[model samples]
Target: MSQDERPALEDLLGAKHRWYHVVDLAPGVTTPGWIDLRPHVGGPQLPASLQGQRALDVGTFDGFWAFELERRGAEVIGIDVDQIPPPDTPQSRWAEVQAELDGAVPGTGFELLRRWFGSSAERRSVNVYELTPEAVGGPVDLVFIGAMLLHLRDPVRALEQARAVLRPGGRLVLFEPIDRKLSKRSEPLARLMIGSTIWTWWYANRACLTDWVKAAGFTDVEDLGTRDVVDSTGNKQRHLTLHARA
Candidate 1:
């Protein structure tokens, strides 16, 4: 990119970025996102080659996973509530950088990168509760939900929507934070909701997570294992990834 493009690129990024993928937007120029999620992209869990497959990325912030799927030869669609404009109220949860930019859009970051990379992956403004086969137009071969469930008020409904959008025997890959202590039990599906100080809704234990997924119409569910992710503050959070078939 030339000198003229830098201002626009800088304007597009959120000041308080909670980046989960380290994306290199241009030569010698990478998005300042700290999390390197590429390691999990082509792993046994994610399946590197999505050639000729139709994939849906739930809650795809900044289009990282959507672009990743496209790079692996899949036709992808990314949906996120962030694609819509926030309210004008003082308590509206708009990003600081978004509030600062002139003519800023909710999905500007994703669009900038998409145009920069010349990708064909599509993105839409949609919430999880509103997801359905009819709303999405058709069922897809793969559905990927990464790190978004815990924030939802109704995860079961979201999972149901995910299931609704998958073709028979299609795959649903989920990566979420697990409350490890609750994994020891085999009874009730335990979920811990964070304090009102944050926007998080429920943090499900491994057992609970699996149970909910199964209840959502997934026939086969596998717990991939607990992986640790570090936050911007260097604190580690344990997350579990699951693979389920609808």
Candidate 2:
């Protein structure tokens, strides 16, 4: 496309669809995403280069991390469910949560950005619980899950499913929300956020998150520490990052 024919970033941002990850579609033309992960691209949270690797991105909203992995030379496949699941709360809250998610199509922004970036990375409609070698073509060398565990009713099971699709001794990198107050304690702890309107189920401490990884059968677990990031809405959130081997 010629410069004169290029779509304005502001016009794309004004569209009805919601984008979850900030992505640079072109020079100075970036998507207005809820979470801007551009800063952490080459950081310790992710491999500096995924040259000659096969990677799976769980909950790949808007394809930011998946595209980054592809940019680093990995053959990437991103997976997400067609419908958003309700939080692990009372039955009374299901209607309200479902109502909020109604009419919101999953993977629309991802498909749009994928086409814009000319990315060969594939996007699949697969739930985290259904992840497997057969489900995602074959085992991958690395599995990346970002900011997704908190929304799962069974995070540990999801982790195990993530593990199932990795080659033996493959890498597992995860980014998740952490409870600042709970993290101050040395013991494993988690705060139940069943009442969250956004469908967040748990806000676990770093230790608790580490334990969950270990319990999922990952080895060489390493907590890479925490960092604060601002969402598109200007809300500050602290997140914990971990790396492990399957």
Candidate 3:
């Protein structure tokens, strides 16, 4: 059946609805259902993740966070670029994402709208730089931008778009990895494996982030990359989880 004809994925996974059954996933795949998505996903536990409340997820690859919010009873809408290469490519991450969610919470009550970030976003990927909050139906309660801000050529403008759609007390949760300030190993990897040398999206400095988030009109900005997290290469890198109110 076409996407329009199929029942909403969240509803199918909801316990209150019929045909309730939680799907299971393996390691590295974490798609959580309504039973509880907050502890693991960060913002899912906040007041914003609920039913009737509205949330806009920018650069949502496979609707992972969207589904989690939906399961919590929030009226969630997710937009992403629908064209991912192979299941193993960067695009396939969400396939695993949905699968894991389906495994965790089978009958969630959420809605997924396939679109992008631009003024004329369709059922595909979006150019975040060109995407506006007005086009997505503004004044949403919360806006989630995960692992997407650093890629922006102009992140400040993007935050402006977010502010345009956000309510007076709305919040923005940014999850990204930052580069190590005093680490000697990080510099070489950026040059060789990461390409182009230092300062890729995989990493950012505090000053740069503060300047951008503040410029975007976000108040009480906090950069929480005070520690290190282990990467696939068995090394620890500086990472951040920031929350700011608009």
Best by TM-score: 2
Q: Give the local distance difference test score of model 3.
A: 0.51
Q: For residues 41-94, write the lDDT of model 2, one tens digit per residue.
A: 644467777899999999888888888889889999999887544334457776
Backbone clash pairs for candidate 2 read: none
Model with the higher TM-score, candidate 1 or 3: 1
TM value for model 3? 0.58
Off by over 4 Å in 3: 4-40, 43-45, 81-125, 182-202, 224-237
lDDT of each: 0.74, 0.83, 0.51
Rate residue 16 of model 2 by lDDT: 70
Candidate 3 residue-wise lDDT, 89-138, digit = tens: 23424465455345442212222222111111122245455456665655
Instruction: Write candidate 1's Cα lDDT for 147-217 as tens digits.
Output: 88877767888899999899999999988877766767766455656444245667788888888898898
Q: lDDT of model 1 at residue 128?
A: 77
Ranking by TM-score: 2, 1, 3
Index of the highest-lDDT prediction: 2
Candidate 3 residue 182 Cα shift, in angstroms, is 5.4
TM-scores of all models? 0.80, 0.90, 0.58
Global Cα lDDT for candidate 1 = 0.74
Instruction: Please say which candidate is ahead in lDDT: 1 or 2.
Output: 2
